[model samples]
Target: MKFLDQAKVYIKAGNGGPGCVSFRREKYIEFGGPDGGDGGKGGDVYAEAVEGLNTLIDYRYQQHIKAKAGVHGMGRDRTGAGGADAVIKVPAGTQIIDAETEEELADLTEIGQRVLLARGGNGGFGNTHFKSSTNQAPRHANPGQTGEERTLILRLKLIADAGLVGLPNAGKSTFLSAVSKARPKIGDYPFTTIHPGLGVVHVDGREFILADIPGLIEGAHEGAGLGDTFLGHIERCRVLLHLVDGTSEEPLEAYNTVRGELEAYENGLAEKPEIIALSKCDSLDEELEDLQAEPIERATGKDVARISAISGKGMIPLLRQIADAIEADKAAERGKDARPEPAWQP
Candidate 1:
């Protein structure tokens, strides 16, 4: 499926039915009073979050949504049928905003979460509604109201366990392909990855999702070199995989440059739980690996894991280490004081 993170749309609620303005015109019934019924309510428009979806591509083609209108009222004090409500299903983590004012409408975080956007108008009154004790034959009524319409924006942020970060051609795409089933375009040049890609890795009967974010460059926070656009996707990740290309002329410089961009864009991004990786180790000789990764580890105060994607050298150990770190982070997140009952107490 084509990935679409952000989209614009217009939604309209159904209008209410008009009130009835009929009178009893039967034989020998000259004293017929006002018999207009109340109008039906209009339909409402709601958006709900659902599972098994991670894109907003559907909204690109269909930018408008409208609810059913209510039925008109009838004579003999008969009310009209209410309009049918409209339900819209969207992917989780989709943020809704009002297009006119650019205000936030809703942030759909969990599955089945819903928010009503537009409300329909009330129905009009019939001529019989004006009947009074003094006036036996009333002849006045109100009309039905119109539904609400507004433009909205929907943007999706993919939730993941870990996110890959680096500069363009820093081997982030290569590393993800080697570890999981994702097939992102990889070349010897820069700016290859245009969007974020997700890969699922299973270890010990447990599956965790990882995201390969587009590479960052200097001044990325200021809209330079892919900007800080894809960084939002990593805000929810429990851990980050910061890859530094081992073949770079200055590996430590490459690491620090990306780190500066992260901190510039988001204050706490630099402080997130991260694992330092020295990619393309197979392309370098043993002596070069020492010069590339050891200095980087010392400079960044992180143990840089060296791995080769093509030859699969040291890939398993790297993945296992990542899984361990992830487990440890989750454990710490729950805190040590979290008490539980026996396993089979039930």
Candidate 2:
């Protein structure tokens, strides 16, 4: 299926049923009073996040969504039936926003998360509600209120534990395919991956999702070479795996170019924990590998691993490092959540 991350839709809630205006007419009773029944409520509109879906492509075809109107009231003091509700099923990690006002409505990060988009109008009062001692007989009934309508925007951001980022032809896709079952398109050209792809990596009996987005080049934040549009897919990742091509003429320059784009794109992505690796190490001998990684290691002041996705060199160690980083991030998140809220100051 084609991946679509953003969509705009118009939705309208159901209208309430009109109240009934009727009086009881009995053969035995001489005086008949107003016996009008109240109208039923209208249906509501809700947006729910469900699993097994990762794209908003379905919303592209259907732009308008509306709920059913409530049944009209009868003349024999019978209440109208309520309208059927309208539920919109969206993928997890979809954020709902008001199109006109540019206000955020809901952010569905987990499966089964639901939020009410629009509330149905209230049912009108019946003639019996207006019956009082001052007014012996009521002849009129209120009309049903109108339903609410609004335009909404849905933006999807994929959730992953680790993100793969590098310059084009840096072997990011090769590493993902070697580590996980995801088989993304592979070629010898730049921008081979036009979109983002996801893979589930299992390391040491532990599983975590990994995302591979389109490669970034220098000035990517300024609309150069894929324009850093796919970077949002990895915003939720806890760690980043930066791959520098060992065969490239200047590996450190390539690494610095991608790093510059990440820092320019903002959203704390630049500060995320990163593990640098020299990819396609099998193509180079020990001397070449050391020569290519020496500059990057010295510039970054960190140890860079030598890996070859085709030959499965250094794959296990890389996966273990990613897993450890993921676990550490999870532990930190748990600690933050477990901390008491400032002890409830008086």
Candidate 3:
């Protein structure tokens, strides 16, 4: 199936059932009394985050979802049956928004998280309620209230600990394959990866998920070079593993190009915790590798990691560095949680 991270859809809740009016009589009875029953409530529509769904392609084709309507009420005080609720399974990390207003509705970050999109309509009153003390016989009934409807937007963000970013053929795929069991397609040409790929890096009894986003180029923010659509996949990443081709004509230029695109696309994306690396180090010698690190590190104001995805050199150290960054981010969040909130002043 094709990967779709964004989708727009319309959802509707079930309508309530109508009330029933009837009269009961016996062979010897002279008069009959009103015996109307109330209708059942309508069904609600909800979206749930479930595992095994990694894409929003299903929502692309089916844009409209509606729940079943409740059954009508019966006579002799027999209430109608309620409508069955509808549940749509969505991928984890899906964010629901109001499509028309662009307002955020819900952020489904964990598995099995559910959000009610539309509420069911209320049931109507029965004719028996209209029978009052003033009138001996009365007949009246109320219609069921309508259900709620809303247009929604569903966006999927990749929830990974570390994200891999680079220009095409920067050995990102190779690095992921070497580190984890994920086998993404690899090629020697540009744009080898058309979609985002995921892998888990396990080192020293510690494991973390790594995502390989498609290569980005200059002018990516202005809809150039595959645009910035895929950038959302890495927005929630705790740390970024920047891969620059070590053998490129100008390693620093390659580094700057990808870095420039990141800053242009998302505000503060460039400021995120990042671990820079000179990929494809097998083609370079020890002297060149040592010399190459200084300028890259000095220019970016960050240390540069060296690795040869094919030869497996520097893989362990690189993985350890990423793990360390992940742990530190977690620690910082914990520290924030430990801090107590200030008391409100009168």
Candidate 4:
């Protein structure tokens, strides 16, 4: 199936039923009073998040959705029937936003989550409601209210525990394939990966999800190459694994280029915990690998790991480091949520 993360749709709720205006007539009765009934309510529009859906591609073909209108009221004090509701099913992690104002309406991160997009109109009142001592013979009735309409935007952001990022040909796909069962296309050319891919990584008898996104080039934030559109898939990751090509002539420049793009994106991605590694070390000698990692380590103020997916060198340590970082971040998040609320004060 084609992967679509964004979609635009229009929705409208049902209109309320109109009230009836009638007078009761009985045999041998000198005078008759009004006996009209109220109208039924309209149907509502709702958005529900469900599992087994990872893309918004379904909305691409269907753009407009509308609920059924309520039936009109009848004479003899008979009320109208209510309209049926319209429900939209979307994938988990889908966010609904206003198409024109870009205002966030709802965020569904879990399965079975639901939000009301548009409310139905209220039923109109009948002439019986207006009957009083001053006006015993009422003849007027209220009209049905109109339904609400809106244009919405649906954006999907994938949730994962770890994300792989770097420049083109930086061995991200190779690394992902080496660690998991996912088989992403690998080539020596740039932009081989046109979309984001997810994999399940098992380390230390524990499993966690990992994501690999398209590589970043210079001026990516300005729409240079593939842009940073795919970056949103990893915004929820706990940690990022940055793979710098060890065999590249200008390794430090390549490292800094990817880092610059991340900072420019400005989605708290730059501040996320990252583990820098010199990939494809099998092609480089021990002396050259040490020399290539020195500048990166000095600039980042942390030790740089060396790994070669082909030779399985440093594989254990790399997976261990990633797992450790993920566990630590999870712990910190739990602690933050467990913190007690401060005592209330004026």
Candidate 5:
């Protein structure tokens, strides 16, 4: 299936049914009263997050969604049937925003989560509601109210525990394929992986999701190369695995270029915990690998792991580090959610 992250759609709720005006008529009835029935309620519009879906491509063809209208009221004190509801099922981690104001209406992060996008109109009252001792022969009825309508924007962001970042052909896809079962397109050219891909990495009896997006180049934030459009896919990652090509002429410059784009994009990506690794270490000898990693280590103030995805060198250690970082982040989130007991109050 083709991946689609964003879509625009128009939604409308159902309209309520009108009331009926009638009077009872019999052969020998001396005092006959009004017996009009009330109208039925209209259908509602809802957006739900469901499983087995990862893209919004289905919304591309179907842009306008409308609910069913309620049935009209009947005479002889018989009410009309209510209309059926309309639901829009989307993938998890999808967000609904108002197209006009760009305000985020709802964020669905978990499966089975649902939100009411529009409410149906209320049913009108019948002539029997106006019947009283003074106005026994009421002949008036109210009309149904109109339904609500609006345009919305749907945006999807992939949820992952760790993300991979580097320059093109820096071995990000190779590392993902080696570590997990996800077999993304691998080639020697730039931008081999045009779209974002997810893999499940298992290390030391623990598993976590990993995301690999398209490579970034100089001025990527300014629409250079593939641009930073795919960067939003990794915004929810707890840690980043930054890979620097060991065979590149200037690895430090490549690393700095990607970092510049991340900082320029500025969505807390520059502040995320990162693990730097020199990829394709099998192509270089020990001395050459050390020489290539020295500048990046000095600039980042951290030790850089030498790894080769093809030969499986340093893969376990890298996976373990990513798992540890994910665990630490989860622990920190749990700590924040834990509320301390309050002191005794008067």
Candidate 6:
């Protein structure tokens, strides 16, 4: 299936049923009073996050979603039936935003999460409600109110524990394929992976999700070479795996270019814990690999791991490091959640 992360849609709630107006008639009765029943309520519109979905491509063709209208009122004090509700099912991590104001309405990150999009109009009153001592024979009935309608924007962001970043042909896809079962397209050219791909990585009896997005080029934040549009997929990652092509003429420059793009992008992506690695080290000897990694290590003041996805060199250590980082992050999050609340002051 083609991956679609964003879509625009219009939703409308159902209209309420109208009230009924009727007069009672009985044999041998001198006078009969009004006996009209109140109308039924309308159906609401809701958006729900469901499992087994990873894209918003289903909403591409269906732009408009509408609920069923309520049935009209009947005579003899009979009320109309309520309308059927409309439910929109979306993938987990889908965010609903108001198209006009660009304000976020709801962020669905878990399965079975639901949010109300529009409320149906209320049912109108019947003539019986107006019956009083002042007005003995009230003949008027109110009409049903109109339902609510609005346009919405749905954006999907992939949820992963770790993400891969680097320049084109830096071996991000190869690493993902080697580590997990995800079969992303691998090519020697730039932008081999157009869309973001996710995989489950298992290391030492531990498993975590991994995401790989398109490679970033110089000025990627400003619409350069595939742009930074795909960067949002990794915004939720706790750690980043940055791969620098060992065969490149200047690995430091390549690393700096990707770092610059990440810093330029929003959401504290640059501040995330990062693990740097020199990829395709199988093509280089030990001395040459060390020589290529020296500048990057010095620039970042961190030891760079030499890895080759094809030959599986340094793969275990790299996976172990990623697992450890993810575990640490998870522990930190649990600590934050477990913190005691401050005592209330009088």
Best by TM-score: 6
lDDT of each: 0.86, 0.90, 0.86, 0.91, 0.92, 0.92
Return model 2's CA RMSD, one decimal.
1.6
Badly placed stretches (over 4 Å) of model 4 are: 25-32, 343-346
Q: Which candidate, 2 or 4, would have the higher lDDT against the true structure?
A: 4
Between prediction 1 and prediction 5, the one with superior TM-score is: 5
Superposition error at 101 for model 2 (Å): 2.1
TM-score, cand. 5? 0.96
Q: For every model shown, what is its TM-score relative to the native structure?
A: 0.89, 0.96, 0.96, 0.92, 0.96, 0.96
On residues 1-346, what C-alpha lDDT tens digit does candidate 4 reach at each position? Answer: 8889999999999998888898888888777888887777789999999988989999999999898877777777888888899988998888899998999999998899999999888777778889999999899888778888999999998878999999999999999999999999999999999888889999889888999999999999999999999999989999999999999998889999999999999899999999999999999999999999999988889889999999999988999999999999999999999999999999
Please give me the total number of clashing residue pairs in predicted model 4. Answer: 0
- Candidate 6 or 1, higher TM-score: 6
RMSD of each: 4.6, 1.6, 1.6, 2.1, 1.6, 1.4
Model 6 lDDT per residue over 1-346, tens place: 9999999999999888787787887888677877776676678899999989999999999999998767666666677788889999999889899999999999999999999999887776777888999887678777777889999999999999999999989999999999999999999889989999999998889999999999999999999999999999999999999999999999999999999999999798999999999999999999999999999999999999999999999999999999999989999999999999999999
State which candidate, 2 or 6, has the greater lDDT: 6
Model 2's TM-score against the true structure: 0.96
- Summarize candidate 2's per-residue lDDT along 1-346 as a digit string, tens digits: 9989899999999898888788888888776888777677778899999989989999999999898777666666777888888988998888899999999999999999999999887777778888899986798787777789999999988999999999999999988899899999999999999889999999889999999999999999999988988898989999999999999998989999999999999999999999999999999999999999999999999899999999998999989999999999999999999998765757
- Give the clashing pairs for model 4: none
Query: Over 4 Å off in model 1, which ranges?
Result: 26-30, 127-130, 332-346
Clashes of each: 3, 0, 0, 0, 0, 0
Which of the two candidates, 1 or 4, achieves a greater lDDT against the reference? 4
* Model 3 per-residue lDDT at 299: 92
Write down the lDDT that model 6 would get.
Answer: 0.92
